[model samples]
Target: MAKKTNKYIKPFKNIFVFILLMFVVWMLFFDANSWLIHHELNSDIEDLEAEKEFYKNEIIKDKKAIKELSTEEGVEKLAREKYYMKQENEEIFIIEYQDSLPKNKEK
Candidate 1:
């Protein structure tokens, strides 16, 4: 009687199972739309979504400010503070914070 030997083949799992595992592994790492690619694309999508939300909030704030600026009082307030506009012959005195003042040099 001759003894048969299966050196490389595993008897526990079928060939089909081994091939299926290999295919899955290849797709996960080496394929074009792999797991790593999917993860990076999802991260990009989340960042873009966050940026979109930020810009949407900024747009809403800008629209509200524009509506406020449509009024005379809003324009006067903005001009007075932002541009430091004053009436003719009006003297404006600016008070600076203590921290903002120049430090004294030791003699």
Candidate 2:
């Protein structure tokens, strides 16, 4: 009876050790927090890439605008519209809208 019991105990102990090792591996490598962190990193990388693309497009637009403004006619048009400069004897009239009022209105 003792010999038979000893034989069965060894196999049961081996199986228990194997199960414990598997549980440790799963917790370290396949747990919920690990997966969540990996997913968040991927999403952050995607967002940064989108922002980089937006800035790249903005740079292209700015370069084109600069090229246009370097020309004589484009410079004249910008000055007239932005600075309100006109030809001699031309009058400048300013229009004010309620929605366009300054932030601080003292009255």
lDDT against the true structure, each candidate: 0.91, 0.85
lDDT of 2 by residue, 1-37 (tens): 5445576467657878779878877876788767667
Clashes by residue pair, model 2: none
> How large an RMSD does model 2 have?
6.6
**Clashing residue pairs found in predicted model 1:** none
Candidate 2, superposed: residue stretches over 4 Å from native = 1-33, 94-107
Please give the distance, in angstroms, between residue 92's alpha carbon in candidate 1 and its true position after superposition: 1.4
Off by over 4 Å in 1: 1-13, 102-107
Q: What is the Cα-based TM-score of model 2?
A: 0.56
Clashes of each: 0, 0
Q: After the best TM-score superposition of candidate 1, give how far the Cα of residue 89 lies from its true spot, in angstroms.
A: 4.5
Model 1 Cα lDDT, one tens digit per residue, 11-57:
42587878898899999999999999999999999999999999999
Best by TM-score: 1
